[model samples]
Target: MAVLEATNPAFEQFVRDTVLNMPAARHLGFEFGRIAPGDVEIIQPYREELTQHDGFVQGGVLGSLADFAAGCAAGTLLPPGWVNMTIDYTVKILAPAKGEKLVARGRVVKAGPVMTVAAADVYSADGAEETLCATAFVTMRNIRAARS
Candidate 1:
């Protein structure tokens, strides 16, 4: 994988490719389509791969997006070799996640040595149609991985 940077001209493109390459994320069609300093946003398609038996999106799918978005947002501020892992995570479901697509928006609320705190909000794609399907808080811990 390439080292990604928030300042990179292709920040969004880089993250989009990287996120889709994640095996777990690919299984559910979670696309990391955009990024900014301390922030990330993704589009999750409402497809059979992520739907529950009753036809609504599975909670696990939403949770995964929330986690990835939060992690990536926190990642934007780190140096090479300073990758983040989800040390703690929490989510609250507020509305039915039903639509052609859903968005997961994440921001790093705080960053410190060894750990970072982040939050996310899942919303519908359509305007005036914010369901606020979910909200997430994430804890990202830096690890001593090899620099990319």
Candidate 2:
């Protein structure tokens, strides 16, 4: 993927602050890995609470991580006073998510004034080994941020 320039100059810092403070991301144990324009990475360590009965990570958790990463990637292109929200997200689980940690990497595929398309790949990382666990596609809609 070609490196895309960021429309928002403070996008990396913005993502760091916004994602770290998000309640759902925090509760789900998501930690920001890399935050750059049109690219984002999130990591979550395996925890019992985030697993299914078979000792694998829950699908919902992977979906949430993908959605979050994709949304953040799209946000980098938004103009000031604008925010993006996920309009559609689909995830395909390719493997059993058994690992010490899961890493989700997302990049914006296309960006426009009102809409953006992003894709993410989730991997299960156990020590030096990594496996593709899921792939996701997300569509985001840009809207004016509501004033508090």
lDDT value for model 2: 0.89
The pairs that clash in candidate 2 are none
Candidate 2 lowest-lDDT run of ten: 13-22
Worst 10 contiguous positions by lDDT, candidate 1: 1-10
Across 1-148, the per-residue lDDT of candidate 1 in tens digits comes to 2343354455455556656777987777666666887888888877866778767788878888899999888877666445668999999988778788889999888877689899999886665566789999999997766655
Which candidate number has the best TM-score? 2
RMSD of each: 4.8, 1.2
Runs of candidate 1 with Cα error greater than 4 angstroms are 1-18, 126-128
* Top model number, lDDT: 2
Q: Give the TM-score of candidate 1.
A: 0.83
Superposed on all Cα atoms, model 1 deviates from the true structure by an RMSD in Å of 4.8
